[model samples]
Target: DVKVTQSSRYLVKRTGEKVFLECVQDMDHENMFWYRQDPGLGLRLIYFSYDVKMKEKGDIPEGYSVSREKKERFSLILESASTNQTSMYLCASSFPLPGLAASSYNEQFFGPGTRLTVL
Candidate 1:
């Protein structure tokens, strides 16, 4: 079975503090993504990596970054935390299927998510 796990289920940080959110997947997926969920804004992608040491900016990548030094581990970094950054951070991984449409290949498995609160 495939599983995704986050380093923490909940986190609290003060404004201007550096924050790191870690995620691990056991399924050996080729793609990993980081998203932030808010009340009304829905789920917004922060970053995604298709291969190790490769990353691409997502919709809301202003203050966020990601690292994928190993295939099974991905990390999201908040340079300096802020109150506006408080939200549920989710990590997802998916195996890429060859010869499949882009929309059909994204069968992502998600972690339990880490709820971050910045004061």
Candidate 2:
């Protein structure tokens, strides 16, 4: 089974402090993603890596960054934590299926999320 693991299940921080969230996937998948879940906006992608050392910024990458140093590990960094950034962070991984429609092939396996609250 494909397994994804995060560094924490819950986190609390003061505004302006640097925060780091780590994720690791047991399956050697080529794509990994980070997302934040909010009440109304739903899940918004933060960053994603398709290969080692290669990353793409998602919709809301202004306050966040990502690092993928190895195949199985992906890290998300909050440069400066803010109370507005409090949300549930999720990590997901999936294999790339060529020639297959995303709806049919790219099913992402998710990790138990980390809920972060900034005070």
Candidate 3:
């Protein structure tokens, strides 16, 4: 089965500190994404990478960045953690559109996210 594993289940950081959250997938998928899930805001995309070393900024990229150096790994970086940035960060991976089987492309699978709390 396809699997996405995040480096941390929870994290605590001081305000203005740098933070990194890592994710790895073993399925050799073609797409990966990072999103912050807030109580009323739902999941807001932060960044996404379609191929190794190639990335695209999502809707809410301010104060955050990403890296995808290896086909199986993706990372999210918070330049300066702030109390307002505290939220559940999720990582997802999926196959290319018109995926493995033309009609088999399904919903994105989510990782047990990293809940980040900035003090």
> For candidate 1, lDDT tens digit of each residue in 1-119?
88999999999999999999999999999789999999898889999888799898989999988889999999999999999999999999998766436723678999999999999
* Number of clashes found in candidate 3: 0
Residue-wise lDDT of candidate 2 within 1-119, one digit each (tens)? 88999999999999999999999999999899999999999999999888899998889999998999999999999999999999999999999776435622788999999999999
Per-model TM-score versus the true fold: 0.94, 0.93, 0.91
Better of 2 and 3 by lDDT: 2
Off by over 4 Å in 3: 98-105
lDDT of each: 0.92, 0.92, 0.91
lDDT of 3 by residue, 33-100 (tens): 99999987889999988889989898999999999999999999999899999999999998777543
Who is ahead in lDDT, 1 or 3? 1
Residue pair clashes in candidate 3: none
Provide the lDDT at 5 for model 3: 98
> Over all chains combined, what TM-score does candidate 3 have?
0.91
Residue 99 CA displacement from its true place in model 1, Å = 7.8
